[model samples]
Target: MPENMPGRINPEHITIVLNQPRYPENIGSGARAMRNMGFYNLIVVDPENFDLEKVEKLSTHAARDVVEKIQIFDNLQKALSPFNYVVGTTARLGGQRQVNSPSVMAEKLIPISKENNIAIVFGREDRGLSNEDIRLCHGLVNIPTADFSSLNLAQAVMVICYELFNAGTKKKHDFNPRLASCYELNGMYKDLKDVLIKISYINPENPDYWMNYIRKFFTRMNLRAREVGIIRGLIRQVNWYGQKMYKDGLDHKKNQEADL
Candidate 1:
């Protein structure tokens, strides 16, 4: 909430999410990592036997405040619902879950973090995120390790926090001045999908399949509000034109004869 530039990271804009963490000490350490990097918002989803006392003890004086402010949720989806940008952390990589290193991710995050509430999610200590859980994320972060890629939950949190914190606070330069909000992007995708379906561009059986790729393509563009509006307007016109020509009630033969 502090007066920052249009595209600078604010602590209030960042959230650290721990999904089903087994140990309270890890949560505490994650909190401690967050505090060290100037982040405070913490969300814990379906944790196991979490103890505030343990968190307080492990987090120590500086990070105790983060422990006190933890928000509990029944599921990952619900916890991340309010955030505009959600980044899932993973050690394993392949398929759709191919992830970027913390430092590389930090560079991409800094701009988005300014205008949106960003959630950086870490999975359980024992097992990492499930495929379904990872699917909900807009992006994924993977820490590159020398031997074993699997990092402890808190250590992964620390690395990401440090990278993001360092990049966010560094020298600021205006980039992509007017980025659209996730809400705006979501709306645009919906309208685009609907229009594409109407025009038979999106197959009825697998409409979402093509739309997903389109969404990713546009996401990489980091479209601004005005850019989104321009695309929306074009789609509306196309839809209107298609509807006018293809309406069921239209007597095409009769209309052609009358015109002749």
Candidate 2:
């Protein structure tokens, strides 16, 4: 193993997540890549074909430790719930998909990885992460490629892991404090969405489209747990006040009818 870096990032705090992978060999190779880069934490969500024998064959005896400790999840949301920071990998880019190069993303994660549990998520081989899947991520990373733009699953993992490993070898710096977990952030978003819908601030039929902007705005803030709690409390108060005013209006209408 190479000498440990003096940076703030703790390899143990960083996790590599594979979402709906189709092949066990890819999974094995991905694990091997992670092991080569000094990362051992691995999580797979809803794999289509998970043959341990094939996986072990590709991963070999060297990465046996990572393969043995792999964590499996039925859904992406559950897989990400415990993380404080989530970075999604994508090939396709367009509206709402703000992507950073692998090196830039790794540098951004250096400080955040000190106190937060970080998850680097890679999508399926055939199709990368969907719009909905991207919504769960705080940021996106794209590995620069030739015109082809497509990379093998393990290749992508290796590219990202290498960037992270290389970045961690730099000098240490002041680390960022602990941030809000996905569970807390998701709950706050749900409450805020409900309040916005109730007050007609967002279109109820297509609220997600509007909420996407809201999500991006808050994601930039890098909110802490206390900040999330404060926001949720405000949302609850707004919901209560809206309901009270509606009830008062109905009572006034009833009184007018009885007097008539």
Candidate 3:
């Protein structure tokens, strides 16, 4: 097995969006968390202080890559438009929009991200993302905390990235940064969805409901790309064998009829 980070595989594509961030140290700390959790992409959108040195200091040695490669964007939309899915992290809740717990949100994102470039946008430290900002996101990610919950910017990033990292492994040297791409997992889902549709287990039109359930169910399994490929290949083989059996049965029946 590969050296495990958080999810065993680094997320193929993930962008952390910080809008009007106040502190440089938080940025550094967040970057550090990203490196530790096997992430490299960091974006700062119109922050108060864009100090690379501060970020480097807070990021420590592990997160140097993230800080070095940081992308600066003029606004949130510009940063997020490229990604297919976005998850916003915030502390506030109770509005027209429904928010999910971090655990639930993480599971929901795992498979989707496997098939899409996923972005997690965080708002300002003092106030968190605005309602309009939250609306831009596909879903909300709320870390579990007390009634009066408060989390530092870096801490929040740490929590979310840690969720993606699979069980930590002791064999540090075997670590490979390559994660399953969105295309690969997309194919797996398509394969699984096809089987389910053919088996008449799912209503083809309203597959999202079932798919969401299945996505969460399978995400917890900590599946990797190679494992997904194995399953996909097996499914195809099973389908092929089933077709062969049916063809053979038809030929045998015709032969008997001719003899008769």
Candidate 4:
């Protein structure tokens, strides 16, 4: 709202990504947890356990907003595509990959959201996110536990949202609106992706090879709208340079042709 800012996306912009969640009750509980923690936007993708009407009942009073406004997507990436920043939530560490502990990641992101679109992703209630799914995120976050670590989807949402809420509130700056809008980041990604395609550096048939890691880095950084815009502008410049170089070469070739 202010000049070019997206108008407080932290409160209105946080979106929950539930990937292949298999329990209706967990979904409801997660929704309720989000509302209790002060986050409202919910996005469920390719869930295995879903009960349209039952979710509200399980949510009790906390999940009412989710029940009324829940949006469903066919895949996690599509759900994540629209977001500028994305973090993956998992219970199991799953191998030895570099990742930030849940609380640590929260500490990093709360301030970052002041400038970018943010999304927190929760895997299935049972198995958690696969190696690939975790790879898609900018950073990995999990609750500290003993040998076994498993968190209900709603419970996970609650913990993460609580951290974010607290982090935002304690800040010194005006928490009114610090980050970019959902649409701005979405458009920037689209523009950048198009540039990648133009350069033939990215295969449209398989964009994940690049988008995943990029998503993780940006999500972890919690970029601002202006930053995203700046990057998009840079991409445009690179593409223009590539075209100009191509045209100059063609002109030289034409001169040679005429001489022949």
In order of appearance, the predictions have TM-scores of 0.75, 0.94, 0.60, 0.69
Judge candidate 3 at residue 6 and give its lDDT. 34
Q: Mind giving the per-residue lDDT tens digits that candidate 1 earns over 1-260?
A: 23363334667888999999999989898899899999999999998978988988889999877988999999887787666677888877886555788888888887676567888998888788887676567788888889867788889889988888777444564443546655666678889999988878889788877977787687667677789899999989998888888774477777887999
Task: State the C-alpha lDDT per candidate.
Answer: 0.81, 0.93, 0.74, 0.73
Backbone clash count, each prediction separately: 0, 0, 6, 7
Q: Which runs in model 1 stand beyond 4 Å of their true positions?
A: 1-9, 48-51, 75-78, 81-84, 96-98, 130-138, 168-172, 176-178, 229-244, 248-260
Clashing residue pairs in candidate 1 are none
For model 1, the run of ten residues with the poorest summed lDDT = 1-10
- Model 4 C-alpha lDDT per residue in residues 210-249, reported as the tens digit of each score: 8666655665555667887898899889989989999999
Q: How accurate is candidate 4 locally (lDDT)?
A: 0.73
TM-score of 2: 0.94
- Model 3 lDDT tens row, 80-175: 766656788878668544678766776665545544577888889999998656645667888888776888988999888887665332444322
| Clashes in predicted model 2 | 0
The candidate scoring highest on TM-score is 2
The candidate scoring highest on lDDT is 2
- Model 2 over residues 1-260: C-alpha lDDT tens digits? 23355564578899999999999999999999999999999999999999999999999999999999999999999999999999999988777678999999998888898789999999999998988999999999999888798899999999999999888545556648899999999999999999999999999999999999999999999999999999999999999999999999999999999999
Candidate 3 weakest lDDT stretch, 10 residues: 169-178
Question: Which residue pairs of candidate 2 clash?
Answer: none
Q: Model 4: residues >4 Å from true position, as ranges?
A: 1-13, 81-84, 92-98, 112-117, 130-136, 165-222
